[model samples]
Target chain A: MNLRIKLIPYERLKREDAKKLVKDLKEGTIILVDAKLDPKEEADLIEETMKVVSTKFSGIELSSMELSELKETTNFERFKNMVIERIMGKKRGLTIIGPAKIIRKIEKNPEELLLYM
Target chain B: MVVKHFRRLKNRLASAIRKVFKKKKEIKIGLYGPVNSGKTTLANRICVDWLGEELGKVTSIPHETREIQMKEKVTIKDNGRSLTFNLVDTPGIATKIDFEDFLKFGMKRKEAKERAKEATRGVIESIKWLDKMDMVLVVLDSTRSPINQVNITILGNLDARNIPLLIVSNKVDLKSSSTSRVRTAFPGYDVIGISAKTGAMVNELYKMVLKKI
Candidate 1:
């Protein structure tokens, strides 16, 4: 319910920073990131997060689909699962790119997001 | 001629059978949460899963739930009660967007601040109905870092009224989900994690509520 969603840049994060992020996040925090603003750094972030969070995370590709279409992919479904689990007070985590392009793509393909949150 | 008569007789019998069990008990269930926390999505999921009809709109933009939405006569059999649970979904509660943030994006400072003030007032108006509900389901988005003030305010007010609450961790199906922390943040309340989209833990949620209401 905290109106202020904490924005964290994946670029500024260290490999061992999960503990802190986890602490702030478990407290019901929202993070805002700009993935498309810096593709290289975002890619590095996704890569580094996977390394840290392990295989429980999956790779997702949106291509040119709108936001709606993006949600339908198996990967989006997985992300929604992670989000839902977190909300339930479960501790599983996932790594996702906060790309406006990706957001646009999913928006274009809203159907894909239909099955997931 | 004989076929017509038989069809008419069948239709009459069906109506008679339905009438015998027409009476239903209605229970009102309310879904409330902060902005962007998926209140409508949860409501849409319930409509799809239980009512077989999606009654509300879903949007990613915060404050999309600007008004109170109610879907009446939702029938659910719980414990020994034959109940009709009306699902009421409310808008997000956020202190309006700071005018300075918009001004920083290139708007006039005074104009931006005024707009921000108006937005803050809108948020208050949207959440004022918390006092009139039978139950409150606080929806929290799990992907973000947990913040204390807004939810604490919501929970504190609800607790003051002694309203039975069910904290729903929505979007739980997303990757990087940390629900345990969500549980810890809210010390004394019934919490449940669910994929509102996949309908994962909803049935279990029903079981929990069945005991309470």
Candidate 2:
């Protein structure tokens, strides 16, 4: 089986719609985004994924980790990190999206993400 | 000072108007969670407590409540205060559904495939029904880690829609159950640990629900 993994910057993912991402997933390509998608984006992606679910394309296995959520931070540091995230317009972390048929699960820990294929 | 006072008055008026309008509409409290997270069990507990019956079937299998099952006019009373709403028991949300998983439960191949198809549709229907809920109870298995994409998505969507939510850390009767873990996972949210099967801490849940809605 030919497997393709695509690394996409958060900016490009934000610019494009989720339908385009689902299309790539349908073609058996795994997606890796540089930044953790915010809740709304994650919800939107799930909605898009559900719309395309079929016998062949069951759905996606998605997991993300935000850098701010990784370690314990003081109020001041957390405020600073929040400011930085707002300035960057994205959370500092990583997101993995894979086709459910190929990827069994994406187990998430507070510090890291483990993908099982 | 004059502008601030005027703004305060306007805000008060808007809030009053909202309450008045809210009273005229039927409130819907939805059960939303991951597959096999004991949402239906909790639903049954809530229904049996107030309505004298169960809302849906509970099973070890995922997606047993594939359709949206609702119990209307479920009113819970606490300290002379009663809150009435339609309790919506939705299909558990899932990102993936594989028929092979069901085959392990000793189901026929055709039955498993059919269940898989219905489960996918159930997921879609659950997502579609999100907008209709006024409040939501997000049920999570206390034995499992709560920092997953599904939980995050469900919480995020509810937050985005400005819906009031309470996180339920279910299955606390199990030895591995840890409500503190669920609390620590989502620090800012309200998390209640309960055993729906044993009716443990369920009254507290009802009180919390009354307060939340």
Which one is best on TM-score?
A: 2
TM-score of chain A of each: 0.30, 0.93
Docking class of 1: incorrect
Writing each residue's lDDT as its tens digit, candidate 2 over B1-213 gives: 343354445434543564678878998999999999999999899999998999888889878988999999999999998889999988888887777788999999899888988887788788889989888999999999898888999987877676778899999999999999998888767789999999999999989887766
After superposition, candidate 1 runs with Cα above 4 Å error: A1-117, B1-27, B78-82, B98-122
Docking class of 2: medium
TM, every model: 0.51, 0.89
Tens-place lDDT per residue, model 2, A5-110, is: 9999999999999999999998899999999898878877877887777668888999988877757756677679889999999998899999998898888877
What DockQ do you compute for every candidate structure? 0.02, 0.58
Per-prediction backbone clash count: 56, 0
**Share of reference contacts found in each model:** 0.00, 0.68
